[model samples]
Target chain A: MSPDEVHYPGAVPPARTRFVRSLGLRLHVCEWGDPDGEPVLLTHGFYDHARSFDLLAPLLAERYRVVAMDARGHGDSDRPDAYAWFPGLIDVVNMLRDLGRPAHVVGHSWGGGQATDAATLHPGSVRKLVNMDGFGPPEEGFHVPGRDRDERPAPGQLAGWLDWRVANHSRETFRPCATLEELAERRRQQNPRLSSEWLRYFAAHGSYHTPEGWVWKVDPMAARNIGPFRPEWIAPGWARLRAPMLALVGSEPDTWGPLPEPMLARRLSHVPKVERGVIPGAGHFMHIEQPEAVARIVLDWLEAG
Target chain B: MTRLRDGRAELALHELGSGAGPTLLCLHALYGAGSDFRDLAAAWPGRVLALDFPGHGHSPRSFGGSYTPENLVANADVALAHASEAQLVGAGLGAYVALLLAGARPDRIGGALLLPGRGLAGGGAEPKRAEPEGMSHARFDVLLQGITADADPDPMLENCDRDIRPPDYARAHADSARLLLLAEDDAERPPWWHAVREADCAEVAPADPEAALARLAAS
Candidate 1:
């Protein structure tokens, strides 16, 4: 189908779509609100597109020019050969540079993690940062030994590792759905709070029609391990961020499950200036499930300081 | 979008572009993902289906850590089930597997593009040893530079921690049209290249993606 032919019924006022070339890949950016208004950048999580912000961007459009971008390998952006958090950080930095001014930045899930990294790595580019449950599993969950000692695969285990990986790679293939409704139903099962209309709208923009069936627009490679998941790999970024940061986690746990209170505190401890909040009755997808509440919280924070 | 399952391991398959032309089955090197062929897919006139070998990209880790040539060949067999007619373009470890696949399923594969690798005949001087436990992001970045000197390295290479004993290529055979893009030295060329009965081989600069594609098209 032609790009122009695709439409969402319950979508907020339509936004202009443009592409930015960064790090040799084309990134899709969607714009809303007055061009002269203060710019606010929005980034979606893994397997999600810029349109995932349809319900939330409009709410912020009144006072801020909101720009929602499809990270490489998702939505209309060109899929990079491999996915990495650093390149994503670079993309955000470039986008902020293009805006010609530091802007309020908000990220959801994987995007949230990237936003946190961006704010930390390039503080001058971000005025304020909001992370929505982006911190993934705690340091222990990564299974890598801490500073005490190093671990290495046993001598004879290499063959087994290779075999296991080949088997695992085969399973990461996209699963096709018979129809958009089917996709919506699957999504609904994951986040029941999302309305059917919004779910359908998300499926429409988040998936591509294939000869076999409808499949997510996300690149399968996006699911692969691109970097070490250890805490040392991430904590430095949190410590480096200079922008005022806010972390909004859902009341209920989702895929990553609940972050233990101690773990949450440990994760946030590195940040110098940060605040925390929880959205009642929402899960990991709090932005979509509680758009108004999230917008209000965000706006109130931005307006206060 | 097809799932090729073999016991505990499942391979991720990606099919891009569309046309009646020949399909290109792309296999990425060690620590590489199927999406590595995105640029090649865009340039090709035909369909391009790339597979993420088990434990590499989105695919599941093998229950047994089985990185043997036999298991890899089996994974390719399942990946091939999704395509009607396809050629093979494999890099590094992928190139080695392509050679094995061509030998195992001559009828299913068309022309083959094998990039830099010490072929199935195995035995290049042992690869420089790098301890995964001691790896830092900066050290990892240097490892990536060794793979491809691009200013920006492919993050997928981070998956290269697990190792496997190289397979002996001396016994493998290539029955179909095959193009071997040789690396700078014999260390990257399979011992079987000189013995392969039917194949077109060339030594091209590894950095030239266009030269490799041109060789594949011409072959």
Candidate 2:
């Protein structure tokens, strides 16, 4: 289905919604395509929900059973008191086990990194791994020194940091927007390539309407950094992956900062078996910007290997 | 990780070190699990038991969905019952909970070292910070991952409580055998630091567990 042919930009094709109990949280899951088809699991990045695959899942449904998960603290998933990476990796592993067989996994951004860890740490659970621009900073970029560095507490200063964070963020509040259209307009200003209709659809699903106004569904605390996320911590997972992997990045740089060629190469070198490709004229949100192109690339890779 | 049944909730307890010295029950702050005290436990002179408070870390969320001080205290009570006679070392919200337990059952708590608990002053103004314009989800994740790895303060949490009132400190102040560790140059101080001092709550710098131990020995 082409973007233009979609009469309901926000309408996701009929899918069954279910909750999976894992890691002490209820994970919201969406199932599309045929149950008999080969399973292909999709994971969205931070602050995004499973519905993010609406534009791409339909295209893959003809040949694969598409399942998308709303990671804990995002979308319809339950928000945990604290957020961490290892717990998320465990959740993915558990989901795969629940599926009862190895499945193809596709992850975007944060989810991409998690998918990499899943395929690497639990090779038996993942058949194939597709990373959509989820390679984080270069090895040297783990700690962005000087910028907001003071916010971080020293080795013995976690108590102070917790006090500061709780004192600052534990309150209940929402950003007031005039309407859903206004929120979509704000989103459009950031993603110029995304059509207004698609932006509205994304906003409708991504935000909640309060009596006062509309606000994002994501928990603000999910954005906080309560633990470690260094390259060393992530590289081991990448190095251990036994599944064939594909890395898809946008040819044009957009947001995720800029991944220089050398940096990208250095990061990808950890993956044992991997291939790389890029979508032209698309940025970080390449799947949304060029779903057809992304779908074609993913389908071709899945079919080839 | 030790699991204990606390009513309907399950508490994950992390234990470390083994010595003749008094057991140091380490309690972590909000948004933190008992694991946050790993380094502290390693450095302590005695056995250390850290607990993942209900709804945080591996501990299951409270059945009532209440994170109120009373509920947290009840969970802490369950954890405290499992440990031998111990000194209490708590940071952030953990500090507050520790003080509450100490106040309710001073006989069980040999001493309490509170790491600049929540009732101190300051942090009233909205922090002058801005989310970068046009930040994508990937960019945000990068920033978050960096901070998480570094154990740095998150900008997103900077001004979230600008309008909310600080937690009340009367109970903590009334607790017995409590010593407060005031970190140097802290950006966030309890609203009642001066009051705590006026009440003769022994205070130290940077909330050093070793120093608190020494002070307790002297006392």
Candidate 3:
């Protein structure tokens, strides 16, 4: 089916799309709101494109100029030869550079972590920080906090990741979905809390049509695992952040994140100035599920002293 | 230079000399390319193959500085697949990979000759403050000087920028057929250098380059 045939009932289209070059790759940046207004950068989570913020961006755009980027290897951005955590943060910095001024930054899921690190690493580039459930998984392997020595990964575990990369690289092409609904169903499997209508909207923007079928626009190789990363390592940087942070997560449980309260509290304790909130009756994708509510919270926070 | 693929990774492999002896696979250090071994390959009596790891030389860069040790080893394995009987000769990061391959593919790798340089001791599992805020044009140019000649400095810089877990050297030790060679008077040897048995190490001496390498290859 043609792309025009796909539709989202109440979605608001981006006002303009701009491309910014960073590290030799051209990144697609979607814009909304008045050009003269203060900029608010929106970053989406993993497996999501800039358009994932279609509902939220418009609401925030009411008072601020919103720029949402399709991070490298996602949406219309150029795919890099590899995807490492540092480069993603660099992309955020470059986007701020393009804005030519410090802007309030809002990131969801993986983007939230990028926003946090970007603010910490390059303080002057961001005025305020808002992160939505971007903290990594709460499991021991990923979030082990105070260990004296750096532990080596089991040889088998390392080998298994390498083997997986090798096998993933061997695939001739991405798996094809017969229809857009099929794509939405796949996303629903991971995000069952989201309504089917919203998943369809997400899938439409996140994928493109091919002669064979529809496939996600994201680079399959972007999913390749990096060497060991622990959340505890991010604590030092969090403690150094100059901008006040607002951490938000949905009250409802979902498949991926919104780490447990005690663990979340411990991680948040590292930040110097942080305000925490739980979006009631929402899951990981709170903005999509309740845009008006999230917007009210975000707008009030940004407008405050 | 020949291009070979292991999964989606494209590697540039350079070959020199041909004889009945086992093929010597030369791996270069971080930012160094396969051509760095051209002089040695010409000197060796047996066949010699040098490979440009991904993001360096002719091989395509993996985006986002994905130069983790596992990724490097996996890409290097593609070159290993080409040789029927091979011995690994590596310096710096190359040496670390050689030690890993020696452990991972004992059947394919008969022995490994490890030399010292950057990446000799793998970045500890969690590297502290590994990321540079951003690289300026002048700063990048300064880094390129004397560090890399034939490859792009970006990937090399990316490779150097992360905290990577060291490979299980114990796995490499299981082979017991490898040697770690160091300079006689070198003072900055890795802390783990002494842990390698004395019998498995050779101190470089004033001798013919070919004879020394051939002697090392034979063990």
Clash count of each predicted structure: 35, 17, 6
Off by over 4 Å in 2: A1-11, A138-164, A168-173, A188-193, B1-219
Instruction: DockQ winner between 1 and 3, please give it.
Output: 3
Best by DockQ: 3
lDDT, candidate 1, B65-137, per-residue tens: 2244445655676677668557788877787677666554556565667665322334332232232122333
Report the C-alpha lDDT of model 3 over B1-219, residue by residue, as the tens digit: 888986656788988667777799988888788888888777676889998887678877754445666667777777887885688888778876776666556556766766666666555545445343434435544533423343456544545534454333433343344444443344564433444434343345325657657765675
lDDT of 1 at A244: 84
| Count of backbone collisions within predicted model 1 | 35
Model 1's chain A TM-score stands at 0.85
The number of the candidate with the highest lDDT is 3
Summarize candidate 2's per-residue lDDT along A1-305 as a digit string, tens digits: 22224344534643787988664568888888898789999989887788778888888887898999888778888776555454577678767866878999999988998888766656777888999988876655533323343442221122333434435445333465878778779766656667788777787777776678777777665665532234544454466677888999998866563377777787788778999989988887888888889999999999993
Over B137-157, each residue of candidate 2 has an lDDT whose tens digit, in order, gives 354345445433433333223
Sort by lDDT, best first: 3, 1, 2
What is model 3's C-alpha RMSD? 5.2
> lDDT tens digits, residues A265-284, model 1?
78789788989989888888
Off by over 4 Å in 1: A1-10, A139-173, B1-219
